[model samples]
Every structure is written in C-alpha cells, then in structure tokens.
Target: MPFAVLPAQICDVEPVYDVYFAAFKNEPIIEFLFPGGGDRKAHTAGTVQWWNHDRNGYTVKCVDTDTGKIVGMASWDIFWRPGEEGAWPKPDGAVWLEGEQRTKAEGVLVPLWEMHEKLFGKNRHVYLPTMAVDPDCQRRGAGRLLMQWGIDIAEKLGLAIYLESTEAGLPLYSRMGFERLTYVHMIHKAEVAGTEEDVEVPLMVKMPSKAKGMAFEDWAKRGYP
Candidate 1:
C-alpha cells in the first residue's frame, strides 16, 4: 500500500503519542528519561505535550492510504534565531532523573549543543527532534515517506538538516544522506553486579541538496511549506 504524508493536526496527538511511545519503549534514551520504570506513560505523554506545545515544530504524519492510519511521524523545527543561547530546552514536565542517568544525560546533551553550534552556527536549518514508526508497521516505507517531507523543504530552502540518530536509526538516516558527525554515549548504572552498559547515539547532519530555485508555491502544492 502507498503512504501519504501530511501535516499533523491537534487531534492527531494521541495516535502520534502511541506510535512514539511504543517505538521507543525499549530505547536507551527512553530508559534514561524515565528511570525506575515508574510513571512511564505519564512521562511519555508529557513529552508529546512538550513537542506539540512548547517546540512549535512542524509535524508530519505518514498515513497508510488504504486504511487511513498513521504509521509513522516526524517532528521538525527551524532553529535559526540569532544569538540563541543555552542547551535545548527540556520538555515541559519532564520526568526527573537522578544519579547516573542525570549525569549521563547532561554529559551527552551539553556537548551535543556545543557541536550543533560549532557545525551549523546560526545558519538557517531544519532540526528534527523526533521521528518514529509504529512497532507493527516496521519495515514499511512509511518512515522514508515521512522523512521525505522534511528533505523536500530543506532542499527547497537550501538549508541543512540535523538530527541525533539512535543506533537503530543510523542506517536509515545514512541512506537518506545524513553523515555522522559525532557520538553521544549514555551509560546505564548497574542495578545488578556486572550489568552496566551504554548506548551510542550518533549526531548526524544532511547538507542541502544542490537542486534549488524551487518556489514556495511549488512546495506548498506538494503539501509542504
């Protein structure tokens, strides 16, 4: 079946949250964000709210045309204001982290912010904060279709695209023209003897495509700004 990519509406929040939660339930960053396994659902919901409310980003959903179901989604924003300072803002009502998890998150994010500024440095660009496909919808082309929405816009604007890629997502992003810039490791504190581990997340960027001179009207007709 074919997939149609469209901008998400406010009513799409619940479904998008479901996909995001299920997709990342076992991801290391999710584990770090909501340690102790308590209030996981609430924390995830809070994240969705933050993305929708605080970030004011453009969200695109990939709908399976035959069934009209949203199988994948990606949220992106332009962070181009001059003189913006500090690390990326934490999600509103974010879950609390303690000990190693807090240290690890801070350690990873602080440097990630520095690298982002060093590389892009106030150039107008698209920043992808989240993207995920439904667990049941894996291996379909929905993810690629959703990503193409951002790629199209970035290509038209001649702006770079940036995202932090999880280990599971690196291959897909690489195929989409993103190159790894650096890696951020999040170490899990050992709850049981000899069980500590870490996850490597790569920071990736895709430079704008050479194809340019497309008008806004042309992009809008294709369902993008």
Candidate 2:
C-alpha cells in the first residue's frame, strides 16, 4: 500500500479528525483530558478546526495513493518570536466542553502548557502537537512518512522539533533521534474504568542534525531512504 504525503487542506478535516480520534481514543492522557469521554469526538473536531483555521502551522496528511484515503496525519506549529506577524490564535475557550468537562479539560491542559512554555519557550522550534495513523494502518510506514515531513522541514530551517510523546509512541520517536527532555504528569480527578490513576507524557526533542545545509536529495541518499 503506497501513500503520498502532502499539505492538508480544509477538506481534509473530517478524515484527519477520524484518524486522530481513533488513534488516541484510549490513550491515558486523553482519558484524563476528556474524563468520561462523551464529548471527546466533539473536542477533537474543534481542535482540528483550530489547527486548520489558525493559518500559522503546517498540517500534513498521508493518503493511500491508490484509494485517496487518508491513512495518517501530522500537524506542526512554529512558535513565533515576540511581536512576530503571524502568531497562533489563542482559543477563546473549549467551546465543545461543558460543565465538568470544561473544568477537567482546563485543569489538565493549563499546567501542561505552562510547563511546555517554561521548558522550550526560548528556542525557535517546531512543535508537533498531533500525529496519528488509522488503527488498522499501524506499522505500515504511515507514521514515518508523516514524521518525515516535519523532519525535513525542521532540518531545512535549522530548528529543533518538540513533541509530547505517549508511551506507545516513545519507541518510534527514539529511533528517529528524539530524546526525552522531561515527563509531564496529570492526576485524574474522577476514577474511570480501564484508565490509569495518572497520565504521564514525555516531552521529547530532536535537534537539527549538525550536517545543516544538506539538500533533501543528499540527505535521502545518506540515510533517510
């Protein structure tokens, strides 16, 4: 099954959301963030909208070339310098959340964002906020294809790439040269069946390769291929 990676368009939202929801639905941190999970899909949809509408990030999709179905997706945002022209839009609120859901969501996200900024704010880097593949499409190279899109761009721009990795994603990221910088933990307020008492996310970073000006063609020939 061959796939092609390209910049995602507005029309790609639903499929991209589907992949993200399916991939993270059972993730511990997602369970912590969404609590009971009734509004998880809606929350994810809103996020997809934010990513697409913000106009300050890159959203890439990996589509099955034969059928044109999106098998994987990845989104990256460059945190701009102070007073930069195109800063990412701040969310007005988690409109998709309500009552307790809203409280829980913010409870978990606020500190996480603060920690992220404190740790990585000084560097001009790319942030990989979301990446997912269809559940059935795991281990088919879709992840690598999607990840390579960011790797290539980061290398070209001489910037490091940062991501918060779930346990399942740690191995693949390690293989790609990302090193764990720190761990972020969030406690669950309400006990849920099959959910961990706490969610631990690893902050990882992959610095640009020292061989900085390497052309894509040469980089591919050397190792990426």
Candidate 3:
C-alpha cells in the first residue's frame, strides 16, 4: 500500500519526530551530525510549535487510512524578500543579526539569512528544512513519495524550493530536481565534532518552474544521482 502524504497536525508530533530522528540517525556517519537529543516528547512539542508558526509550513506521512502514525515528514516555508511586506531584511553580509538565525528562521537574522540569501537571494523560495523517514520504512519509497508531495506543492504555489543536505541525502535531492547551489564548510568545535553528532551540510536548490520541461519521473531518475 502507498504511504499517504497529509497535513501534519499538532497531535502527530511524537511519530513525526521519531521519523525525523530515524531518517537522519545515520547522519553521524553520513555527515557527522545529529539534532539535540533526549526528551523526545518535549522536542516534539517544541517542533509542533515551531512548524506551526506563520512563517513556516510542513507536510507529513502516515499509513494510508489509518490513525496518524507519522512515518515521514517534510517541512517548508515561503521566502519573503527582505523589503516586502512581512519581510526580514538585512544589509548585505550583515553579521549583527547572526545570533537570531534559527533553522526555522524565527529569530534567525545573522547566520541564517546571510547563508540563506547568499544562495536563494531575495526571492520567494520554498524552504525545506527537514525531510526524513522512519528507519523501519527505508528503501520503501516513502521518502520519494514525501518529496514528490513537496515538489507538487511547490509547483502549485509557483515557488522554487531550497534545502541543505547531509551526504546521504545529496543523491535523493538531486533526483528530485534540486541542484547544487553552493557548499558550506563548517569546522565544528572539536568536542562537538568528536561526538557521535555534528553534521556537514551542503546547500542545494530545486530548478525553478521556468527552467525546463523534464517530466517529474524522468527528472527524479536522471538527477537522483
């Protein structure tokens, strides 16, 4: 049976976080990183709160026709140029705003925007921060289905998508119509890098709607490398 892509509700937090962690567990070896751990319940609650924020968006997966048991997830946002209504603007390469740049870009001003705009510029880009599938469900096309849902939504909304990836996800994103926008090199604190966490991320971008005519399936196969 096909995994269903659905709007993730606040009640589905636990399972969604489970999938998020499982899908990225190999992140340590794949990219030498992991999100902060422990108190998964609290983390889930926080994530639910974060994703529900007005500036962000998300989609999740569950077994078709069943009570919500989130098996996969993809979260995104609509990029607002710095000077537009509800826009957060910074002078080019401004570092003073660095302390606020969160992954969700809530208070993120410094590091996040500089890094974000450096690649996407001041356009309406679709921001996909996390995409993961449960470990028990790997190799079963769950990730692909979730990703296609993201692509479909992006196309419908007429926005280009942007993301950063660990080593394991590079091929998958490439196949989903994303291209290498730039590479970010990081030197984590030795303690952090030495731990079984800390990931190296490579930023990527999906070709804009106007770029080409490749069918989704064909594009998925060709660039999935």
The runs of at least 3 residues in candidate 3 whose Cα sits more than 4 Å from the true structure, single-residue gaps closed, are: 29-36, 64-68, 80-83, 86-113, 182-192, 195-200, 212-225
- Model 1, 180-221: lDDT tens digits are 663333233444112355444577777665524443224324
- In the range 90-154, model 2's lDDT, one tens digit per residue, is 34444566787666666656665766565554445678989999999999999988898888888
lDDT of 3: 0.59
TM-score of 1: 0.71
- Each prediction's whole-model lDDT (CA): 0.67, 0.71, 0.59
Off by over 4 Å in 2: 31-52, 80-95, 182-194, 210-225
| Candidates sorted by lDDT, best first | 2, 1, 3
Worst 10-residue lDDT window, candidate 2: 185-194
Model 3 poorest 10 in a row by lDDT: 100-109
Candidate 2 clashing pairs, residues 3+ apart or interchain: none
Clash number by candidate, in order? 0, 0, 13
* lDDT at position 156, candidate 1: 77
